[model samples]
Structures are given as C-alpha cells and as structure tokens.
Target: MDVVTRCVHRESSVEEIMIYTGKSKSYVKSAISAAILLGMIEQLNGDIYKISDDCYGILNTTPSEELKTSLFKSRIEKWEPFILYLKYLISGESSVVAIRKLCSLYSFNRTPVQIENLLKNWAKSTGILDATGEIVDINLSYDENEILYKLNEETVNDTNVSLFMINILGENIFSWLYHDEIAELKKAILIFRDHPRDAIQCSGRAFEDVLRRISIQSGVDTRKLNGITQVANNLYSQLDSTDNPFIHSKLKNIASAIGDIRNMAGHGKEAKSMERWELSSTSAIAHLLLTLSTIKGIYSYVNENRYDF
Candidate 1:
C-alpha cells in the first residue's frame, strides 16, 4: 500500500521508491512489481511508474476502507489466476488442493511455495479467504457464482469461453447493443439461477431483438421475418460475398438453436403434463449463457463492420 501511495503521488523509479519508502532495493522492486500486478500502478518508461488511471482516487485524499476493499476486489476479480483459485474454493476444494490444481494448470514461473503465499496473501487481503485459508461467507451474487461454476466445469476443455463470459459480465463488452437489448440481456443474467426458464426466454428475446435490428439496418424486409431464424437467415444472406461461407452457416445454426430453445421455454409439451417439456435448471442456464455468447460474437462482428453487413 505504501508503494502504491508513493506512486500515486508521483511517478517513481525503483531507486526513488526505495528512497521514499526507506526500504531495501530488493523489497522496493518486489513491491513495485506486486503493485503493477494488482493494477494499482503501471510502468511508464523503462523503470519509472505511476498510479494507474483507474486508481487515481487514492492520489490526495485518504480513501475509506470500503473504497479500498472495492478497489482491491475489482482489480483482483480481473486476474485470471485469482479467479481460478476462487472457483476451486467455491467448488468445495481445500486451499491446498486448489493451490495444487492452480499450479498444475498454470505456470507462474515461481516456486510452488511462492505461488501459494501470493494467492493466500491476496485471498486474505480481499476477505475472500480467512487466516486458515478457508473461503469466507461473502455471499457471492448469483451471476458471480454461476460464472465460477462454469469456469470450474468448462475451463478444462475451453478456457477461452470462461474468460470471455467473465469479460462480458464484468466489462463494457455490450456497448454495441442498444439500451433495450442490453437491459434484456442483463435481466436474463440476473434471474438465470432462480428463474431459469424466464432467463432463457429473456436471452432469446434479446438475441431476436438484435437480429431484427440488424435486418432492418441492412434493408431486409423484417415484415416477412416470422421468427428469429428467418430474421437471422435474412441478415446472413445480406452479408458481403467475401464473408466466409462456413462462418455464415455456423451463425445461422446458432441463431436457429436460440429460437428452438426459446420455443421450448415458451411452450410446454401438454397442459396436463407441463413438466415433460420443462428443461432442467442447469440446462436452461447453460442455454441462456450460450445464447448470450452467440449474440456477443455476432453483434461484435456486425458492429465492427456495419457497412459490410
């Protein structure tokens, strides 16, 4: 914290930080590196460093403990290794076991002992783990827990999916989406755990809404679009001839799947035995996430090259 505070006040080199903190050269260097890792500071030139722009609030006035903790938590939440560690803890793994898994999965270029100490220190400091290295009752929000569960289950096969989902939820990746579209997606994510069916419905609606917007922008006659599939296909057909046929075909399939899932949620098998058509909560949540991911990818491509579409 002292190193960060020093950097916040002025850009400092390693020697300057050592002089300001009255610490040994090695200790100052290590502190600066840790500060950079935690996103409290950023390297400027070769050796000089300053507080990160997002952390400038700590420049002059003393921040409250709540603000400090919020900053710490937000920064660490973006750290992949720390996120993996938290996922293991959420899945009932012991700290030792989680540390071992993390070590095996990622090469941190540090000794196991060093990695263990670093994780424990960050975990304890952020109140995520206690002194005993056990998870605390922090009452994680539904979406946060859902993300952790997905990361724990799916990262082994496709690590990028977990990270992409995390960024979608945590960052401003949806700026391309209109206000109402963004609101619907947020609604889906918010109720995905308790109201899985409704969540999937919301996700489907949001995705369909995007398709309709794109179709209209591309001069397609949306009046003839009967459902998401038609809307999606019409839009895809309008894509430039240079677009890859394989990608176009795959996107159409994904959009069609979203419509099919929405229909399953929208209509039950029979009024007498509605449960027959009801999807499991797990399946519904998975479908909702998949729909969101699909929307994210397609929307991003269209947004970047709107004129082409």
Candidate 2:
C-alpha cells in the first residue's frame, strides 16, 4: 500500500521507492515487481513507475479496508502459487503442510518459515484463513453453485474460469483490452443469474471485442473486418507458419463457436410455428465460462509471442 501510494503521486524509480517506503532495496524491488504483476503500477520508459490507469482510482482515494481487500483478492485470484496453496487448505491440509507442498511445486529461495509467514499474511488479508492459519472460508464471496457449476464434459469449473476472467478484466493480464471490452464481461458475470439471455449477449460482445483488440494489436487493417468470424480468420492467417498449427486452427474454431452462440442468443428464428431459441441460467454460465477461457488462451498466446507480432 505504501509503495502504491507513493507512486500514485509521481513516477518513481527503485531508489525513490525504497526511500519513500523506508524499505531495503531488495524488498522495494520485489514490491514493485508484484505491484506490476497485479496491474497496480506500470513501469515507464526510463525505469520510473506510476500507478496504472485501472488502479489509480483505488489507490489515489481514501479507500476503505474492505475495498482494499476486495481489490487484493481479485488481483491474486489467477496467481498459480496462491491458488495452489488455497486448494491445499480447502482439501484440509494444515498451513505447514500446504506451505511445504507449495515449496515442492514452485521454486522459492526463501526458507519454509519465511514462505509460511508470507502465505499466512496473504491468506488472512483475503479472509480465507486466520492468523492461526486455520481455514476461515474458501468461497471468497462466490456461492457454491457459482464455484462448482458442472459444465458439460469439461472438467474445469466456473470458479476457475471466473478467476481468469476477473484477472483479465482487472488488467492483471491483457491490459491492452479496452475499457468497454472489460465492462461487457463484468456486466455478463454480474447479470448471468438473473438475466441469462442478456448475459449471453453481453458475453458475446465481450468476446467480439477481445478478438478485435487482438486483430488491431497484430497490425491487421480492421477497417474491413466485419464480424467475429472474419476478424478471427484474419488473425489466424497472420500467425507465423512455424508456430503451432493446431493452436491456429483452434483459434478460428473458438471464435466461430462464440459467434454462433452469440447469434443464437441475440436472434431466434421460428420454425414449424414454434420458437426455437432458449437459454437457461446454467447455459449462460457455461457460455460465459467458455468465452472467458477462450479469451485467456488468446491473450496468453499473444503475450508469449508479442515480440514476433
């Protein structure tokens, strides 16, 4: 918080950050790196940093503790190491056991005691665990149904997909996505339970917007791009031939699938004097999950090959 607050007023380098926070150089650097990853700050051209556009409002204001906690939780939802630790706790593992397991899975230069302290701090702040390292709750504001929804044959649940979407919308990843693109997905998630049909349409808009963003970033002339299918196909052709052919094909398929669902949700036809379009809450949830998953995949691929693009 101190680091963010200092940066909010002006761009700061590592030395400035250390002085402002009254911390050692190494600690300040780590904090900066974490803040960058969380999308709370951005490093500028000359190694100076400032508060990110998406996060300036929260850090610049006198944010309440509740608001800070919510922001922190959303930022870290996609962090694999923390998510793994949470899973261990949910499976009834002690804090010590979970820390050990986490160490085995990820390389940590810190000793077990240090890692335990760090994990405990995060857990407590997120309200998932107590100071004693006991489980407080695992839902993290989501209900059981939203977290545990079964999506056909796919093993991934709604919670996992929702976390990924939140990460994207929060600008933790794919920060280049526009404000409206992010807002559409947020609207879809917020209304899915009460307005499934509207949620589906919102999800479709978000998906299309993401594809268009990718196209623009890749230097495609989007002036002629008409719909989701055309934009996706244009992107697929732009991929290097040496890259994975399977992913290229899958990108097109995913975009087509999303476009089909969006069209169905937005427009229904009458056949045999009977209306043929319908959507349940479960179906909307499933579609939104798929949309989030697809966006994550595309963004991950883009990030990995950004230099090539």
Candidate 2 backbone clash number: 0
lDDT of each: 0.68, 0.69
Q: For candidate 2, what is the lDDT?
A: 0.69
Q: Candidate 1, residues 90-157: lDDT per residue as tens digits? A: 77887778778777766676787888788889878878788888877455433545453653343222
- State candidate 2's TM-score: 0.56
Q: After aligning candidate 2 to the native by TM-score, how far in Å is the CA of 221 from where it should be?
A: 18
Model 1 RMSD, rounded to 1 decimal: 12.0
Local accuracy of candidate 2 as per-residue lDDT tens digits, 1-309: 677778878888888888877999888887887788667889998879998887787665456677777777767664556666666666678878978877876677779888788778877888877777787764432333444353332333333544445443322343345546756776676667678889999989988888887766766666777777777877877755465422356767987888887777887686566676878887887788788778777776665642210
Cα error, candidate 2, residue 157 (Å): 15
Could you tell me which 10 consecutive residues in candidate 2 have the lowest summed lDDT?
A: 150-159
